[model samples]
Target: MTQSDFDDGNEDDVPEWADRVMADVAREVRRRRKEMKWTAQKLADRCEEIGYPIPRNVIANMESGRRAVLPLVEVMVLAKALYTHPLRLIYPVGYVEEVQQLPLTYPVDTAKAMRWFAGLNENYQADHRMLHHHIAHASALERALFAVQGEERQRWAAERAIDDTARAKALRTQADFAERAARAKDELCQVRSAIAADGEPLPDLPDTLADVDPAEGYERDTD
Candidate 1:
């Protein structure tokens, strides 16, 4: 279905690209609603239950592409009701390869667009690169923790084999991963402090790293 299918008699006033995005939104809404086995009425009920209260007919109009205007609030509420992030509905990264970030701009990679939208791409916001570093370190920390667990299991299996060579190799690998994990955790804490010093809101730490004190890094620097 195209944007014309949802024309509300004011197409000239709105940009064609904007209309296309709204059409995509409508398509996604219908696709996700059906994917979840929800009827229009059921979706409406959910909207009401969640305090937003989009009517059944309004949802129908959107699904059919007859409703051209979609407010940001509606996008947010619809996403919440559908159990997804607003960016997922707007960008549909896996469903589409590329999307136009703005009117008149060439379409870019969907994943890149999603990152820009979430302010997680340093290229998009050159002045604030710390956010990107924080996320990168957090990602590294999680992967290192997973690696530590895998190496520990391998070490245990090697011990059960009663082979000194295998046991030594496994122990070495486990120690390497443990050191990587410790380095990642310390970097993450230090980055968290830097981000906070810049007057940005601190990102939430993972449960495993929640007790790490960012201030400890500061105190060490002072010493």
Candidate 2:
């Protein structure tokens, strides 16, 4: 078997958990390939058509548990070629249920929140930072109100009270941007998910587009 390099550690010897995961992947790949009645070469050809080339022997080795590491990009391309979601390849059936059943420190939305942050514009991010800074200042001031003498505490509290109006205005603007960003992300996911479902039947054409080439326009009513 030809050697494959893994980023986790020594390329020659892989960890047990990774090996187990790869074993599951190997089994899933083999199962899906058989379900589609496709030869390894055919799968390879499809992958190449999509710009990721996987040779037949490599596919064989991967299925036979000879390959130590499957690159992430290859797994995604393989899932694309095999006509299924990448999650189905990496995780077992009922995996979503299993994950939801486990206790966690943070909400699952945290990952999506990070992605939303990453996609923010520089101006929007600056606004976000400024809002956060203002919030921190308000919070610190509010806390100091409890620790100070009578007038000093009142003064600290008054400062936060004075900023409340401006803070609310800034937050409203950020909220608008955040809502639009979320809607755009959801729309993007829906479209890409439709593309990933390559084996499924296409959606029916819209009423206006049914039965005619767009360039020719709708067939004129002919008696």
Candidate 3:
């Protein structure tokens, strides 16, 4: 599978629309960085301390709108360093939402979910990222498997074609969870009462979802 050709260019080379988006990103990043009272060097150090390495100059260039190729990973790590959601870096001003959505079993309180997300720190974000990927890297298989019966339809456009190496690599986490979820029958099915009441042990799992790990990937409901 070939890698996606992400657009990356300097302000001079990027088109006006692209430049405006970059400037918006820069302003938000700068605003968040300043809100935390963190210097560019501090952000660099923090990023390196975890795993990824980004230099101060890179941060400076990004904040100054000189750097155009803002890797999604960079945005994630930078957001962690700034103690804010990654969406804060890219979404328009005065907007508020979880950097990403949490995949709960059922009956999730949307407000509570937002609060739970807001409370997460860098420590939690790594696992959270593992639980859900940026919308850009989600697979069609994942997108289909994630939703439940009769919820309003979510945005389907974020479902990406394959070849997301970094994200797909991280997607390997917790195969057992997928196994369990796949084996779980619909609780509300009318005919399911006989099977459930029979108290028969679950049969061996189907091969379809064998390697699927729900945590590592799922499409977002909205932008």
Candidate 4:
């Protein structure tokens, strides 16, 4: 028998199982790209810009199940570009089940997670503060521009009005941030309570954590 026939594993010459796996990978790549609102050409351009240099035709071939087995580095590049894990592309379905069955040897990073949460809380508070500042400035400008008359006056007044509107909108956004901060604080409290109930030392909340209290006259809701 010829080498091609021998490689095919039968006289009927069916595609190998490896081909199917590659096809699945390709399909997933295309599917994720589409989900991210990117076209094949757009994805190719992004890949090239990111130093991966995948051609449109190669992408098309892979999506169409004609190409098999991408390089490991290429798989990693693709996953980074797609904002997904490399294993999601490489492993077949149900592989995560196998991962879960493995023993957990590493300690969970509760401190890191709490730190991240606190950082987000601080960012939200900063946004709210900035928004409040803008609102105050806009309101002041609107008040200052009220006495002028003429086209120049009219223009300034209109601009101030727009700024005032923006300020109001910013206030609403600030309220949203406050609500989110409150929820995060509640979560932290719950976690602390759980730890206390277990007779463990109370984990200190991160210094980055924001103090969000509606009773302090910080508006919790704007509308």
Candidate 5:
């Protein structure tokens, strides 16, 4: 039999562990391909360009968990072509025993506080009340200072400048509140590293959350 035909042995010859590993690899390959928005043919083309003799049928067999043995060279080539680590493609299933799970405590909902503060200005009546009370009070003080003359004007200007500085500081505080609130709502995933049975912990997660801004407002991008 040809080497390719010999390589494609009957299912019974494969060990259970090998079968599991191949299955995991197949699943991961399919997942990575889909994540990269590449078709089987596109992946094959990329492999060909990278000097790896990977055909569409070979890709299909690998993804279908039929061709179990993956050479290190091919793994490296595929990983480079797909922008991933070679180890990621080979050992897709992480040994849970090797992973260190940390105790995670969820933080209090700061976003709710910000939302509540924002809602205060949502209604027209509430807005009008703020305008007449807080805003008008401040404006009145500004007008009073501007209306003065000579030394009184200078003194009033200094006082008004202090008020303006205070108002600016308050606005900055509000902005920080908003930022912290938005950060609180973000979905977080933390992975702790652990020493493997005979290897080191893989630094990268299979999937990750990326920051993306929503068209309308700030949003936490996650996959």
Candidate 6:
């Protein structure tokens, strides 16, 4: 019987924790593949269709724990082929309670680990430099715009509502989203001002936000 690479290696010769995580990933891959009712050949076909071909035997080895390494690129391409997010396969946020995210650290809350992996951890973002903060604030404004647009869609849907109460509720949601957009625009202006104060060139606002006065608090010269 051929032993798994990890099983044959000395403790110091292998990263046991990493191999264990790979085993977990192997299980997940098999599970998702089976759930989709796809054969290994079918999965390989999908990988090729998506422009990265992991041979059927290679995928079989990965699923059987015979493959010692899973490359980052393969992980990404496999994710695209499997119709799932790479992070979901890597950490499995809601499916597991905890995960050992690093070599030496204790197991972390799975959701927290996933968030950190995805660069969504608030504490990590808090330590970013001013330019990152500026980008984040700009993203917030864009998200607010999307939120308002979604609310507008709901309001439009309310036009087809048979009940006055449903229509009123949708209108209220639109109003609330509009208020949030206004706040986001104000925050964006502040971010631009701070960037200008720091001697950085302000980025152009999105066309939807063109009406916002980015230089609102700065004094202008009157010749």
Give Cα-based local distance difference scores for all models: 0.73, 0.55, 0.50, 0.51, 0.48, 0.74
Give Cα distance to truth, residue 121, candidate 2, Å. Answer: 27
lDDT of 4 by residue, 22-92 (tens): 55467678878988999889888878888978888888877886676577787777888888876566442
In model 2, which residue pairs have backbone atoms overlapping below 3 Å? Answer: none
Model 1 pairs whose backbones collide: 6-65
Q: For model 6, how big is the CA root-mean-square deviation?
A: 7.0
Model 1, backbone clash pairs (residues 3+ apart or across chains), number: 1
Cα-based TM-score, every candidate: 0.56, 0.39, 0.39, 0.36, 0.35, 0.62
Tens-digit lDDT track of model 1 for 1-223: 1123233444453487787788777778888899999999988998898999999999999888788699999988899899888888888877877776766566678788888888767664475566566666577667656755666777686677677887887788778777776776676666666665665566665565665554454432232
- CA displacement after TM-score superposition, residue 110 of candidate 3 (Å): 20
What's model 6's TM-score?
A: 0.62
Q: Can you write out model 3's per-residue Cα lDDT over 18-80, one digit (the tens) per residue?
A: 554456567778877787788989889999987899999999998887786787788788878
What lDDT does model 3 reach? 0.50
Candidates, ranked, lDDT: 6, 1, 2, 4, 3, 5
Tell me the number of clashing residue pairs for each predicted model. Answer: 1, 0, 1, 0, 0, 0
lDDT tens digits, residue span 101-190, model 2: 112212223223333434444455355644444444344333333222333434444456558776565555555544544444344334
- 2 against 6, candidate with superior TM-score: 6
lDDT of 4 at 113: 30
Better of 3 and 6 by lDDT: 6
lDDT of 6 by residue, 1-223 (tens): 1113332334542476687678767776888899899999999999999998999999999999999999989888888888998887887665666766766556677778778887777766566656475776678678767765766787786787779988888888878877877887777776666666656666766677775664355433233
Considering every candidate listed, which one attains the maximal lDDT? 6
Candidate 2 TM-score, true structure as reference: 0.39
